[model samples]
Target: MISKDEVKHIAALARIGLDEKEIEKFSTDLSSILDWIEQLKEADIENVEPISHITGMENITREDKAEDFENKDGIKKMFPEEKDGYDKVKSVL
Candidate 1:
């Protein structure tokens, strides 16, 4: 179990203000957390494998394909506003 002095030291390190009741509550909470960690240490993980992720994925590479078009005028016509054959937006700054 956590001690009163340890709780006070932790509060000071964290720059927190704690009254007697808060200190006692924190001490109990920290003890419970530590107990949980101790229990987890007893888990059986001897045959378990370390993995970055569980899902399987294929790393397939593909050649880049390019298709040329002459739709500049069509694109400009769909724009909200166009000036000098180019789309225009509100200026920043």
Candidate 2:
């Protein structure tokens, strides 16, 4: 069972502000989660092998290629501001 003080301490460590009602609610929720964990502790896993992923994933293959667009000038003209053949922006600082 999780205590109210424990819930408050955890909330403080996480930089969360919780009222009394919220603290009580979280205490109840955390206690239920702890109970679920305790139940999982008794599961049988003698033949279970540890795996990084549950499903098999394969790396997708693609052609190592580069292509140029047909409308370079049209794309360049879309920029609102440009300087010296490059996009321009106002100084931030």
What Cα-based lDDT does every candidate model obtain? 0.89, 0.89
Clashing pairs in 2: none
Give the number of the best model, judged by TM-score: 2
The whole-model C-alpha lDDT of candidate 1 against the native structure comes to: 0.89
| Superposed Cα deviation of residue 27, candidate 2 (Å) | 0.8
| Candidate 2 local lDDT, 41-86, one digit each (tens) | 6889899886887676767789989988999889778778977777
Q: How close is candidate 1 to the true structure, as a TM-score?
A: 0.44
lDDT of 1 by residue, 1-93 (tens): 999899999999999999999999999999999988898778898998867766856576787887777886787899898898877889977
Looking at model 1, the pairs that clash are none
Name the runs in model 2 displaced over 4 angstroms: 44-93
* TM-score between candidate 2 and the true structure: 0.46
Global lDDT for candidate 2?
Answer: 0.89
lDDT of 1 at 19: 100
